[model samples]
Target: MTGGSAGAAAGAPWAEFGRRLRSLRRAAGLTQLQLGLRVGYHHSAVSKLEAGLREPPVGLVRRLDAVLETDGELAAILAEPREVPRRTGRFPADP
Candidate 1:
């Protein structure tokens, strides 16, 4: 449960990352739209990232860590060992 990978047991890395992001954003008293503005993304993009419907880019994740004052907790979730699902075609589905 250390290293901030505790969410791994709950679900996929991206999902876990989203969960953490949502929690941190709330703790910082920011709405998704506000967070998106601070991170240079649209509110819908923040919504997608929080819903785990999209994998966030590394730079964004780092920005989130800084914005949320996590001191690297968010980044540690990405460092956890896990099999990330890959899209195979034009129309792809998550595993």
Candidate 2:
């Protein structure tokens, strides 16, 4: 949240990233609490990340990429989400 990147951070890509996270989490049959436990975060934190209301810490994103077995896809989104092709099939539809 440093460098005035707070409010300015949530864009189309950010929202997409959230959807992607939710999709991945669901596909793995993981509740927010389950993923949070695996990632050293709280369930509320996961909720915020999926809601695009907060930016994920880089380390956390990396951990998520690993824990979710997304193969760096989550980190890739943060790195260049705009280039990520949206694929609802690849990700379960968010409820």
Candidate 3:
């Protein structure tokens, strides 16, 4: 889905990460499209991240941090512990 859950939007770590990303992007005077291009992602992907609709992959987070010159602030947000969804028995095990 392209939207964050209500709980996630309500002060989740990813949401905080998104907020920081937006702030840094603005401080750097870069548009979403520009940031995406610099980080090798589509602008929609950047929008989704800024909206807290997705958790960025680790590699992408590093790229974002570097591109935005956050000095590891962005990475630190993701490093904080969050709850993992436990798989149900009905679902196949992840590879």
- On lDDT, the stronger of 1 and 3 is 3
| CA RMSD per model (angstroms) | 9.0, 13.1, 6.8
Cα lDDT tens digits, model 3, 3-39, are: 4464567565478888889899999999999999999
In candidate 2, list every pair of residues with a backbone clash.
none
Going through the candidates in order, what is the number of backbone clashes in each?
A: 0, 0, 0
Candidate 3's TM-score:
0.75
What does the lDDT come to for candidate 1? 0.82
- What's the TM-score of every candidate structure? 0.73, 0.71, 0.75
How many steric clashes does model 2 contain? 0
Candidate 2 on 1-95: residue-level lDDT in tens?
A: 35345354456446667879999999999999999999999999998888777778999999999999989998888887256565666766699
lDDT per residue, candidate 1, 27-70, as tens digits?
99999999999999998998777766678899999999998899
Task: Give the TM-score ranking, best first.
Answer: 3, 1, 2
Q: Is candidate 1 or candidate 3 better by TM-score?
A: 3
The candidate 1 region of ten consecutive residues with least summed lDDT is 1-10
- Candidate 3 C-alpha error for residue 39, in Å: 0.4
